[model samples]
Target: MSQRILHHPVLGSLEERHSVQFEFNGSVYTAYEGETIAGALLAAGVRTLRVHEETGSPRGIYCNIGHCYECRVHVDGVPTVRACMTLVQEGMRVTAGSVLPTPLKKGGHAN
Candidate 1:
């Protein structure tokens, strides 16, 4: 995954925050303090957060204000947590939302 740090031309380098370890899709990732899960995922170059249960289509962060439900994910066995609204914490375990009964294979859609 590519580095997701942004270099603002006007604001210059952003202040560094303490790094924390988190897990996404069973993989450990580093996230900075005060950064939302969505932001950390984006920084890690992750786009798709979950698959729509009905349509089986991939969904990602949208709206980003806790209004839209597009960025839902399973965090620590809790289903339907909003990625954009949740803050990353040390040892956090994040997983993509799954379809009930069986989860659709990655990149696969319902027939």
Candidate 2:
């Protein structure tokens, strides 16, 4: 028998696993129903989510609670989305753009 190596951490005892599909750099990735895109990305060893808007520096989740803006990415064709706070949905498409010195608001409510 053969097995595959695991990269992601085990989510604690979730009851149901809903299948959700999303794209990363034009590649497809799937996660459980309730998992965040950032969580799933980390599980799959995705370190860099977006590039710095100005400096073009690589960034990821500095704070899991959405305090830091390091893990910003574009979701569903929208730009400047905070990955730590954004929940994963079925067939969601995201784009990673360069970071900016000043953060911009999309929905007008700061996360």
Q: Write the per-residue lDDT of candidate 2 for residues 9-106, one digit (tens) a residue.
A: 66544455677888988988877677778887877778899887767878888898888878889898888788888889988998787646666555
TM of each candidate vs. truth:
0.83, 0.74
**Model 1 local distance difference test score:** 0.88
Residue 69 lDDT, candidate 1, scale 0-100:
94
RMSD of each: 6.0, 7.8
**Cα error, candidate 2, residue 69 (Å):** 1.1
Residue-level lDDT of model 1, residues 14-95, one tens digit each, is 7877999999998898899999999999998899999877667899999999998999998888988999999999999999
Which pairs clash in the backbone of model 1? none
